[model samples]
Target: MNVEKKRVLKIFYLIATSSEELSSCELAKRIGVTERTIKSDIKQVRDFALDNGAVIKSRRGSGYWIEVFDSDKIQAIVEQLVIHFAYDSSLSDLSSEKRSNDILRKIIAQDGYVKLDDIAYELYLSRSSIKNEIKEARKVLESFNLGFETKPGFGSRIKGSEFDKRLCMLMLFEIYYHKAVLMFNHTQLMNYFECEDDVRNDIRHSFLKVLRESSCHIMDDYTQRIARYLILLRNRYKAKYYISFNPEKKVLLKSFKQYKIACDIIDELKKYGGYDVDENEILALEVFLLIWADIDSTSDLAGDYGEVYFEALTQLEKISERIRQEYSIEFFNCEWDKKIFLTGLIPIILKIKLNCEKNDMKSSVLFNDSVRLSPLSIKLSYSAIELLNEQYNTKNSFASHLIIAYRIYIIISKVKYDYSPIRMIICSMHGIEVARSIKNSIINKYSEKYFAKLDLYELYEMRALKYDDYDAVALNYPYFSYKYDWTFVLIELIPTDNQLQELYNKVILQGYQLKQFLEFFNFNKNFVFRDFNFESMESFINLISFKHGKESKFIHNIEYELNECVIKSIYNKTCILFINHQYVDHNIFEIYQLNEIKNINGEEISHIIVLSVDFNHSIKAFKFIEQLSHQLVIDRETIYLLTESEKLDNIIDIVRKGLNSEMISLV
Candidate 1:
């Protein structure tokens, strides 16, 4: 019931219909197979037709003709085949296995003549599987052949007269050439052929042709369409795949049987769900899916996908009642029209949504799935390829899934095509976070390709770098100032109202002093600073309690180094950054300990007490949390968060709190 296998069989019907009394030679030429193949296929064709009540017979020694038992039988067989194709697709491969066995039996009984590769392919086995079976056929059917026979190279033979032998051999070869033969490799054949439009369109069409072949499930048609659809699907998604069997599942168990269409839209609620994208791009994605679907419509990818396609047609006839009965878009329901296929409307719809506009503004062919990137905005060399990456990596996507991507892009285009300046805000529920990380990785991998822009809002779209909330991007080392501008901004956790105001005041008062220090020492043109929680329980001694000196020595050292730095200003000014690290917490021992300790601004100022001389700052909270070190109340991230902004408000609050009690300045 393998859906793909059934589709391939359908291909045989088309190939078979294209010829007159097609012999093994004719079939091999038309279907691009070999004579050996045709020889084996005839038997399969006979058996399949007979099993379904068709007659494949030879008059004496001329050739073969396939006719159903009668008109009713033919109609019934066609209907049955279609039904089987539509219900469960997993059994088409089994049909080949059965056909192969039937041929093997007939060859042994009538003569050594059977279509082999058909079964081999349909069974998803290798050519060797057929060879091995054929070798054993003579022994298994010896009684039927009366020990009739096969030489090293000669095919199976009946002991009857030469005329009978020729008849059987001819029919056998016919089966091999048409029914059983596996024809052109899809990829290679595509290379040989020139597509009508772009590579993507061509690929879509080739897949459709193969799907049609598979739908018929005729042996010859199957031969003509081998591997084409799989190859194309792989190309579209950039995914590699091959039929695999699970020994545990034993899907091929003769008793196990449920074969239907490859994909049933009704059952696949996800793939075919109604409109999952924005208006601008929905039509485009829809049209694109239709084109893709049409190319491989041999089976039903029509799951959720079919709804999009069906709606596009505006099926005013059948859906007329449904449309009027339900949501009412007007009762102009009909098929999407053959025009889409002829004019490459699907691709047009997609490309147009991507800004590849076409003449028809309202072609229902469009489908906008947010996974697709902006068309109005310039796209990468292979933007579609990036989407394919999602298909391969996560088996899901935004453009193909939720409409968030499209909405984001619309916002971005309004602001500017380049989202480098904007910070992309992501919620846990949104899928952008995943894309954000991946995009950053890609950016780092190809630094030259990007200008090193960090936009949180467009992180997923542009492969931007990641910046944690409130984490300042170090602008230290004035020599490197020219290389970058516009420091990335992240929101800080303003612990409390007191802390927020304290920061504003600290920045305003210490603005010039701090700016001078950075300009002289670290050469940071733009100082990004902030403070987290403010407390009254801490003092300079608290820093000393942090196992050693002030744990926030990192901040102090940065300030101390900046104060000692030489400025390029014409005034030849030297600046000092006095930050008092005392707060409400009474862990004074860990508060004010660093280099060149002394009293400044009425409090002890810590020097290069931190690990880095450039990241020095006052961490009064660090001193407070030091008391709970064993319990590890404050983690590294907390430390980072507390020092998110370079503003001294938190430090000021700490100083004010320390003043309320007994405070000591280490500097």
Candidate 2:
């Protein structure tokens, strides 16, 4: 039967077995089909039931149910359908995913060319269906570095390295057979492989014994997979199809301790199964062992495995550093978390380095869904894959990035700090008690919902206070003077509801300001250039100018402002150069660490801070830029931190801290 007919049969079976009426929505959801498709299929089901001594009844409010006039005939129909749909639900044509998988399995299982007509007949599909599935199967084959070859009359075959072919076969076997259950019964194995039960049992027993003797901690699923691989290998070797390894790689594999384990398993195979295997087969087994064997810690990876262990550690550290430099987030803070990540990461790194990475569509879809939820994690994962590709000289796949990003998102979700807080100052002229009362009331009201740090100050001490240290000021007296429009909330001596709400609104505004500041800068690593050189001031100005073809005049205005208002000073070990310009359409900020000291206006300078702001930009954003300029000239510690920080994220954090202070003054 075709897939749609089979689906209709399955639907009829569901309706017959259901205790309650099944709605079109429920049936569609259960069958993974649309409600419209379900409605049409129900009509087909009704017609088929009428022909087979059964009736499908439906109501306007309720859904579908089945009534049988001839139980024997209905039972016989269900029995025949069960043979096709019981073990694998994919036998029903729902989507191309399973069909494509089946195509891959059929091609990989055959020794030589397999005809399209033969596959179509076996799958109960049309020739067109098989052709469409072939395209998907080809994509999967290409990912495994295998080729799909077809002839006019001879049919199609998979072509690739023997090692890759075996890997592809193992992966497909995992998808098709072992997906439902980790363990397979002796009868199932014998029937599937067409081998004697004793041969399958011997292979399983030998693999388990070798793994146990080597103190390898592998999951049950992987153990079953290894057994399946060995069974397939034995069959392939019997067919005179053997694997060949590179001479250099074979030598390297022989030196590893896993090689001995591989040898032990092969010897058991030869003794019990009467199999003939060679050194190349042993090397392939060693590679499998290397990829699958789980090590709890670096100490567990003794002997030749130590090289892979160390390389995994180095690559992990590089990824961690990249995340930190770009996002200002700590990646590996806890040693336990590091160990957990290392254990999971080692296998993947081994897979990539050894060219055995499995591209499972289900796993890729799941990880991609999870990574999409976190925008920052998505960016970090992309950056991480780029770093790995550069270091290894290999093009990693999207699935690889998704996997890494999912792991990174998990770790970061736990360690990332809540950096948003509204700093507020509470003052009163009525006395300290009134000030304390108002502060306590505000804290008791908003502490749970909003993060606000409240401090008490006398009204007389306002002039002595550093305005930059607080975001909002609450005072009983209304008379206050400041250059920038500060968030001021005038509270009553006893604090009325209206006064408290005003204070809360000011806190909300401060939060908005903080958010805008962060969004404006964004703090991309690309903004910071290290060891950059420019010969003259004109060249540097032109390099920083925005490229607008028709707005050359505006660009010239920005360049003129930058040259006119540039500030140069020698601070500690570096010459700090600060350049600020206004009247631009958008904000631009960059930091440059010169390769050597340059003479700009006869002043030696090594570092440059460029800030360009739009005249129409938000006051809060402009204040932030102004505050940063003020810090660069007067704050010696800020200068030291900006110049001496190794990671761009550290510099970003420093600047972010300055911006968060919300201090506004004349520049």
Candidate 3:
């Protein structure tokens, strides 16, 4: 039977096992699907069960129930169905979402094209429904930069670099398995991946043994997750889908200690488990270990990233400095904050450069919502974005920016709100009357928002006790050290507003802010030339003019106009020179890169920005540049990150979304 028949059989079995009649609505809720879908499923279930020794009886008022004449035959048929749906079903069977995920796995697992007709037949869906599934599969494949190619006779296959294909397959495993859609326990998963029962048990034992032999501190749960990753890796290779890592890239990963251990583990799997694993798969496993192990700043990312690791570090350092300068908050002081920011930021930077996925509009909503909750973080985050947009060649998607913002929010939440008001347990020796009086006075004097909650506890019960559950202790009686760092407030029989104010000051810490307004500047890539020499800077303008077949004097005219605008470094590090030319044939706004140059007035000089406007497109360019300049002053990091790796189209798309100007034409 195909998946749809198996589903209908499972539903029928459920109703048969039930003592009472079941309504379609109740079954739909249990199955996590629509009532209409359940009704359709019931028709198939009734037809399939009738010849198989069970009759589904329905009355006018009552719902549906099952009656069996030959229990032996029905039990035999049900056993057959269980064998068919093994490892993919639960107490309940697959829902529509789970079915879709299964279809995706099937498509990826196949080494060659899988026919749409075969898929439809197996899933018990019409051609149209299967077509819709294809669209979803394409969306997922496109996000990984894999091609969902189809031919008239050849059907379809996901095409991509082997490295990316492996990454996508592993990510799919993580998403579906974590959600319990695959519904396979460790041993079952191994069996599904084609491991023999003995081999499966040995692999499990060997994986744990390897972890023990090495002093790795991964928990059992994480060890299991890694084992699942290995299953997928071995399964893919066994099916002839292999990943080949570049020899140059492989050399770079040798610096990581985990890489060596991963290699040893693979060797053991090959020796004992009767599996053939490739060198590239071993390298990929190392990447998975680093991410899943949750390594902090102590991790040598250079093993996976090569020289770019140091560049990423410099970028993170610059971002931290901006946050500290703008918010007056320190991050490095808190080890948790430092670890989180670094671990999250490095992978994100690599993903952006690789253009691994498309940005969903929903992630932008999350970014905005997070910023709304914290107002001060916005200025610093925006500043970071602007700097990144201006400096990097890479294009950052809104989703990418949102992830960066989330990491920043994690750090800022610790820095900004760590001293928020505490919950209190009020204790008094004078009985409930005195405690009530103090509590009422405090509540009426200050809003309940200032404190989490106030509870009354008797003084006698406070002996030899530590109130660790509450944030602070409030009492009128004398007390000794309880070994907690919480605020302890004592009030008189009647407390004054002045005493309340002092206590409030101690409870609520002061926030940080910039003493002066910081200004920013925006430079287009055409204008940005890193380590530029004077002759080369002038040569680039002439080359552009010559390429457009314009007059040589027009180039000289641009040089003359450059004097009108001040050329200075906006970040106090790199100088940018920009010129807006009048009435050119093309509306050109290009950023040019230059190799580093020294001995220009005994100081390093780089970046030449050109933002030229044609007579007709002048208004649009002017409006866009105006908005760009504003973004530069407030948030340079946005510009820097956007420009650093590459994403001009995305940056322009962001600008187009933000600006509703009729005069500004992005196309």
Candidate 4:
């Protein structure tokens, strides 16, 4: 089995070993993935289980649990499969992340300095390759306050405070626990602490007993984390690696309830291991105890008391006020909702305060889909969060922002739809020469009488255009009028008196509908054009960079992503709509109108739209592009309008209102 397969197996193993069914949300959180991905992963796991003579039982409201018959045989098969694949030299072929993790685990599990050559040999890689892996792994370790030290003879080793060292171990364990447990086994894990099996077992018992005796509650996840820390702390204590708490930490320690708890744990250690724990070690334990308490309080935010709770509430109040001012949506409408939400923010605030590391897993696929599916919620939540950050000096993670977005999404879904202004897009093959006047004349005629906004676009014979953004797509020529599910109208650039009245009746008076106000004529009786000219694509990319990537810190990231799309289009020689959302936080899209200039060889090329938005707001944009690309093969008039039209602002405006349609009940 590959590592991914092994991971799925481990998830199944956890579910099988659990006493109760696990929710998809909780499972995704534990596995550091989005719930949407988890659902698909679960289905794959279910299929695998069926072939393996096992069952994954799921209930409608509850969740999934595993069922296995003949546990011994299943265990034997799993263990054998895991060991075989995990130890194979093919492990070197794993992704850079997996390879780096392998090297890090090897470095930390060793008793002394780990030679690069030894790692290369173990993982089947070159010495220089292992060095690069170590370099990458160092980045991850640094987040936990751990660093690497290199000597002349011995290669390199991790050097950090004993506390940080244990924390790094736990963090790594979460990502590669199954692989490490299977490959290194329990004995090596004990060897990392320079202890025998009996000593390790005694330390575990004493640590838990102390926690139980002191009535200090530890969550199951944190219990595993603390247990590992205790083992390392014992070895470090024996080796005389004690913590030297500064005056500031000591001052903070004085008021901590966990201090007494730490003292009790130290007494238990002395009883079991027959070692007199020093004052410095006791203080170190207290620090760990305090951290444990922080973790515990965060587990159930509503139940937490004291400074953390009050501080979060204050921040929430400022955030709420800023949101109301910017979006005109009242967030603090009910005291009950406010309290529940404020409690939720506690964990997010704690994470920022601690500078906790997040999993490298990208935002779940569901997150992207949800943002598109709930435009109103996304718009309000994204705008509000931006304002909150500026006003309250709070830096929330993307995931935290997503939580707020989801909450507002639910609330907004429950309310009645607000009246929205109708947006219409007009396209003409005569280009901007006629599009502007037609749009202005129509808007002037109808603006006072109806709630509608009209914009004009030029029609392209070779380019696909997305008409979904507009309530109606008005076309000038018959062949130019593409068939789409959206409301479309065939009218002349200069409408006749009867045609103008018919347009007013159909669009302004009749709300929204498909209407051919004027008769369609085949005006292109004799026309043949093979030449297609376009302005330099780079100019538009630069324009977008100037518009969206002015922030110096993000310029490189933005350019790097843009270059990938540019390269992709150039190599394929295809008209592309590039939407890069890797680093942005708001919606931004740009169109590069292709000009019909000729080269020395008189060859012509096409143009593209470099529409970039935040990752959350990209689903609808991507769908639009996908459909547009298909339409390009069947109809080219849309691209003509896009390149030749002067209504760039109108096109952008319609796209800005892309996902903001009112919710319609199927019933």
lDDT by residue for model 1 (284-351), tens: 22222332233322333233233334432332133233322221223121223222221222222233
Over all chains combined, what TM-score does candidate 4 have? 0.45
Model 4 has a clash total of 14
Each candidate structure's count of clashing pairs: 135, 0, 53, 14
Tens digits of per-residue lDDT for model 3 on 251-286? 755655668778878888887643567677887776
Reference-based lDDT, residue 482, model 2: 34
| TM-score of each model, in listed order | 0.17, 0.49, 0.48, 0.45
lDDT of 4 by residue, 88-128 (tens): 34321355666776678777755678788877876667877
Per residue, candidate 2 scores C-alpha lDDT tens digits across 261-371 of 888888877876645688888888888787665656544543446666688778878987765554344557677557656665666676676676545423324433434
Better of 1 and 3 by lDDT: 3
Model 2 misplaced stretches (Cα beyond 4 Å): 1-93, 176-192, 195-202, 268-271, 274-276, 298-304, 330-345, 361-379, 390-393, 397-667
Residue 408 accuracy (lDDT) in model 1 = 22
Which residue window of length 10 is worst by lDDT in model 3?
A: 511-520
